[model samples]
Target chain A: DQQVKQNSPSLSVQEGRISILNCDYTNSMFDYFLWYKKYPAEGPTFLISISSIKDKNEDGRFTVFLNKSAKHLSLHIVPSQPGDSAVYFCAASAINNDMRFGAGTRLTVKP
Target chain B: DVKVTQSSRYLVKRTGEKVFLECVQDMDHENMFWYRQDPGLGLRLIYFSYDVKMKEKGDIPEGYSVSREKKERFSLILESASTNQTSMYLCASSYPGTSGFSSYNEQFFGPGTRLTVL
Candidate 1:
């Protein structure tokens, strides 16, 4: 069974627009959520993250929102640039447990 | 900066052959992980090591074994390569997450090795 899932396989947006990527989880024990951005052949880079205690966390143009009650989280990027195009993965983990990753959503920002 | 390096960018092996994939991390991390990424399956952990000589099987560990002789290097061995095992292999490293109720450590991954078993 998949504990974490990214329902959307891909998302596209225009430059300078907002891009939203959603993720859901079935495990209630997960207390921390993170987003990672991956280029074509490179490893994934850490993006923003949020603790379950907080509803939202923002870093520069990236913002991550967590809803514990709904078991869902979303990453928002404002003024999305072409460089923002890549695969986004949502990961969640509990204390002492290995992180579970979503299938990843490919984001493409057009000029 | 944390850097994880894999032994190869691509490898092709025949069935029944023994294959070894090596990974090295420069950050002196205590945790190392091996995962296989497929088109729709994303990334699935094959094995992980918490310390030198200590290893744990992840969700999928069949036909795979791992070794961590040194703190900086981890090796994944395929007992007998199979066609189904062809996929992109990824290596990751992270610090030990000992905090109670919070295992929020971020993992640094390698560029990945594409392995093809024919």
Candidate 2:
């Protein structure tokens, strides 16, 4: 069974607009969440992370919101640029367990 | 910068052949992981090692074995290559956290090796 899930396979947004990508999880033991972005032919790079204690974390143009009670999280990018187009993966993990990743969501920011 | 280097960027092997994929991390990290990435499957861990000579099975470990003789290098061995094993293999490394929450540590990944078993 998939513990983490990204219901949307892809998302498209216009430049300078806001893009929202959602993820859900079934495991309650997950206390930390992270987002990784990947471009074609490259490895994934860490984007932002949030601890279970916090509901939100932001880095520059990217923001990650976590709702522990609802077992959901969303990644928001404001003023999305064409360079922001890539695959986004949501991962969750406990203190001792390896992070479980969702099937990534492809984000396309149109010029 | 943390650098994780894989032995190969691409490899092709025939069925029943023994294949070895090597990974090296320059970060002096204690944790190393091997994962296979498929189109819709994202990334699935095949094996992981927390310390030299210590290894753990991940979500999918069948037909795979690993070795960590040195702290900087980890090797994944395919006992018998199969067509279904063709996929992109990724290597990642991270340091153990003092807070006992190792998952909080960000993992640095290699460029990945695309293995094709025919």
Candidate 3:
């Protein structure tokens, strides 16, 4: 069973606009959530993450929000740039355990 | 900078052939993992190792095996290649966090190898 899920397969946004990618998880034991961005023919890179204890964490233009009660999380990128277009994956894991990944969402930023 | 390196960027193999995909990390990470990426199915964990000479089966381990004889190197093996095994393979490594939550350490990934089995 897939414990982590990304409902949307793709998301398109205009450059300089806010892009929101959402994820949901069925496993409540997950305490850490992470987002990874992947470019064509490249490996997934670590993006942003949020701990279950905190509701939100931000780093410059990227932010991750976690709603533990709802078992949901979202990645927000402000002023999206054309270079930001890539496949984004959401993953969650319990302490010291292997992570569960979502199917992934492809984000397209139009200039 | 943290770096994980894979043996191949792409490979083609025939059915019944044995294949080896090797991964090495320069970051001195204690945990290493192998995952296969396929369309729609996303990234499925094949195998992982938390220490030298130790291995654990992930979500999908059938027909696949892994080796971690050293801390920096991990190998994924396909005993008898099949068409269904064609996919992109990713290797990742992460440090064991001080808090005992290995997930706390961000995983660094290699460029990945695209393997095609006929």
Candidate 4:
């Protein structure tokens, strides 16, 4: 069974527009959620994260919203640029360990 | 900055060959993990070690083994490599207790190793 799911396999956005990527989880035990960004030929880098206790977390141009009631989370990038185009992954962890990752959403920001 | 170094950037081996992928971290972190990345599958954990000589299987540990004899090093071993095993391997390290800026669990990942089993 997939505990974490990213239904959208790909997303396309125009430059300077906003890109929103979604993720959902089935296990309620997950309390920590993290997002990672990856470019071609490189490993994923940490992007942003939110805890179950918080509803939203923002970092620079990126913001993450978490709705525990819906068991869903989303990453929002305002003024999306071509450089922001890449694959994004949402991961969850319970017991402060054993992270579970989603399949990933490939975002293409057209210039 | 936390530096996690992987031994290989790309490797090619034949089926039934024993493969060893090594990872070293200089951050002195207590937790190390190994994961495989595929096209449709993001990243799946194979194994993790919280301390020396201690290991735990993750979501997908079949056809894989691990060794951690020291605090800064973790190794993933493929007993017999299969073509299906060809994928990008990633190693990550983090401070064991918590994650993120406020007592969090942010992991630092190596560049990655792309392995091809022919």
Model 3 Cα lDDT, one tens digit per residue, B6-67 = 99999999999999999999988899999999887789999988889989899999999999
**Looking at candidate 4, what is the lDDT of residue B12?**
100
**Whole-model lDDT, candidate 2?**
0.93
TM-score of chain B of each: 0.95, 0.97, 0.95, 0.94
Model 4 compared with the native: what TM-score?
0.95
TM-score of chain B as predicted in candidate 3: 0.95
Which residue pairs in candidate 3 collide? none
Q: Which window of 10 residues has the lowest lDDT sum in candidate 4 chain B?
A: B96-105
- In model 1, the runs with Cα more than 4 Å from the true position are B99-102
Candidate 2, after superposition: displacement of residue B64 in Å? 0.4
Measured against the true chain A, the candidates' chain A TM-scores are 0.99, 0.99, 0.98, 0.98
Superior by DockQ: candidate 1 or candidate 2 = 2
Candidate closest to the true structure, highest DockQ: 3
Q: Could you give candidate 1's per-residue lDDT for residues A1-111 as a string of tens digits?
A: 889999999999999999999999999999999999999988888898899989999999999999899999999999899999999999999888888999999999999
Worst 10 residues of 2 chain B by lDDT: B97-106
Runs of candidate 4 exceeding 4 Å displacement: B98-104
Cα lDDT of model 4 by residue, B61-94, tens digit: 9999999999999999999999999999999988
Tell me how far the alpha carbon of residue B102 in candidate 1 is from the true structure, in angstroms, after superposition.
Answer: 7.3
